[model samples]
Target chain A: AQSVTQLDSHVSVSEGTPVLLRCNYSSSYSPSLFWYVQHPNKGLQLLLKYTSAATLVKGINGFEAEFKKSETSFHLTKPSAHMSDAAEYFCVVSALNYGGATNKLIFGTGTLLAVQP
Target chain B: EPEVTQTPSHQVTQMGQEVILRCVPISNHLYFYWYRQILGQKVEFLVSFYNNEISEKSEIFDDQFSVERPDGSNFTLKIRSTKLEDSAMYFCASRGQFFQETQYFGPGTRLLVL
Candidate 1:
């Protein structure tokens, strides 16, 4: 089974400051990792994903994440935080079933990002 | 770009009543999924549908829940008897058959069971 843990439940950053959200995962096999962001009352939107293609993945809205295999971490980062970036972020892990069925996704509890203007 | 769409942004139902949440996935996507998130809780997977049948499901998808693709365009999640615990925001997602493709999500339906 695959699981994810977000190190922070809430993170506050001032506008124009750098932002960092930590996440870690546990998977027996090779895994696919993703970062998703949800605005207030809105559905989840994919930020980026690491499918073993690249260690550093750049996503929309000037966000990026680096998949570090040795540390089992996939942390999201942004050079500058914007007030509009205030939202909840989730780290997800996906692993193919040993039985050859479809893959299953495990989500982290979520981290709430608050940007102060 | 194509996107997934869901119906009834919010719904309220009495206990034991049956409710159906509807979604229209991206036209060309071949995989569909349903996930739910309780207030202040992590999102949980309910089921995955492909090739007109359920390909995978989580323990949360019990006997009370069923999924149907009544037409080529619409996918539905039916709760046989809704309980108060069933209240949550249900999301529908779809993705193409390609490897490691991102799943596109719908706006979601907030089901409130009274």
Candidate 2:
């Protein structure tokens, strides 16, 4: 069984300050990791994904995350916070062993990002 | 860029009444999926469809749930008998055949069972 854990339920950061959202995963095989953002009453948008090609992955809206195999963590980060960045962030993990199919995504509970102006 | 689209931004129905949620996946996508998120809960997978048939389904998807690709472009999820607990925001997603491809999600339909 594979699962993702987001350490923080809520994170607050001041404008122009750095932001971080922590996530960890447990998988038996190599995993595909993803970060998605959802605004109120809106659909989820993929910020970035890691398919084993690179450890440091950059995403939209000046966001990025590092996949650390040793730590079993994929934490999202941003250099500066913006009001628009306030939203719910989800960390997802997908393994290739999903009965030979790949559309399944195991999601974390979610972390709410609050940007203060 | 192509994306998935779902109809009925919000639907309110009585218990025991049937409801059908509709979605139009990306034109060239081959896989379709349905997921739901209860208030203040993690998103849970319901089912996955391919080649006009169900390829996979989660434990939550039982006899009461069914999926169909009525036309070439439309995919639908039908709940035979709705319950108060069935109220949630349902999301439709689609993915192409690329290895480890990302799934695109629709705006989602909020179903309120009264």
Candidate 3:
């Protein structure tokens, strides 16, 4: 079984400042982790995914996440936040489905990021 | 730059009415999925389809819910009877063989049962 936990429900950052959204996961196997962003009235956009590749994975919109197996954490971060970066971010963990490993995503509750100028 | 497209951005139906949500997955993707997100809640997986068959389904995908690939290009989810609890955003997703685990989502259909 796999589950995702987003530590923050809301985060506010000033424009051009750094942003951080914490996430943790519990999985019995080598899990595939991802970060997705959903803007207002828009569809979910994939940020990045970690599948036993690089520990630090870079994604679109200058965002990135580091998969720390030691701590069972995959936190999303950005060096500079833009006004457009305000959105709802979800942390997802994927595990093999019973019988054949179809892989289903277990999503977090989501964290709302707010950018202030 | 392929995408999964969904129909009826918004739909309003009465209780006990039936509704079908349609999706056209990205061409060449081998796996397709349906997920739902209730208002202000986490997204939950409903079902996954592949090879013209259902691979796996969640507890929420009961007998009242069924999925089908009526044509080569389109996949649909049918709800036999709409309930107030069925109101939510339904998203269609697909993943190519290359990105076997990275599923891309569609714009989603908002179903409102009254």
Candidate 4:
């Protein structure tokens, strides 16, 4: 079984400060990791994905995350946080099925980030 | 950029009534999926469709749930009997014809069962 755990339920950060949202996973195989952001009243948007290509993946809007195989962690980070960066983030893990037909994502509970102006 | 779209941004219904949530996936996409998120809960996968049939489904997608691609472009999820527990934000997603592609999500439809 594969699962993702987002460490913080709520994180408050000041504008222009560094931002970090911790996420850990338990996977049975070499998994595909992804970070998705859901803005208020908006659909989910993909931040970044790691598909066995690069350990360090860059995403839109100055967001990036590193896949650490040793620690089983894929933590999202940004050099500076903006007011618009406030939103809900989810860590997802995709494991291939038994038949290897297709892969499905298992999402984390989610972390809500609040940016102070 | 192409994206998935869903119908009925929100719906309110009584228990035992049937509801059909509709979605129009990206024009060239081949895989379709349905997911739901209860209030203050994690998003869960319900079912996945390909080639006009169900390729895989989760435990939550039981006999009461059915999916169909009625036309070339529309994919639908029908709930036979709505329950209070069924209330959630339903999201439709689609992926294109490629290996290890990213799934694009819809704005989501909020379903409230009373």
Q: Which of candidates 1 and 4 reaches a greater DockQ?
A: 4
In model 2, residue pairs whose N, Cα or C atoms come closer than 3 Å (at least 3 residues apart or on different chains), thus clashing, are: none
In model 4, which residue pairs have backbone atoms overlapping below 3 Å? none
Quantify all predictions' global Cα lDDT against the true fold. 0.93, 0.93, 0.93, 0.92
Chain A alone, TM-score per model? 0.96, 0.96, 0.97, 0.96
DockQ (C-alpha based) per candidate is 0.71, 0.75, 0.72, 0.75
Q: How does model 4 score by TM-score?
A: 0.98
Q: For candidate 3, lDDT tens digit of each residue in A1-117?
A: 789999999999999999999999999877899999999878899999999989999999899999999999999999999999999999998867667656878899999999999
Clashing pairs in 1: none
lDDT of 4 at A24: 97
Looking at candidate 2, what is the lDDT of residue B70? Answer: 94
Which regions of candidate 2 fall more than 4 Å away from where they truly are? none
RMSD of each: 0.9, 0.9, 1.0, 0.9
CAPRI verdict on model 2?
medium
TM-score of chain B of each: 0.99, 0.98, 0.96, 0.98
Q: Write the per-residue lDDT of candidate 4 for residues B1-114, one digit (tens) a residue.
A: 998999999999999999999999999999899999999999999998888788889999999999999989999999999999999999999988775899999999999999
TM-score of 2: 0.98
Worst 10 residues of 1 chain B by lDDT: B95-104
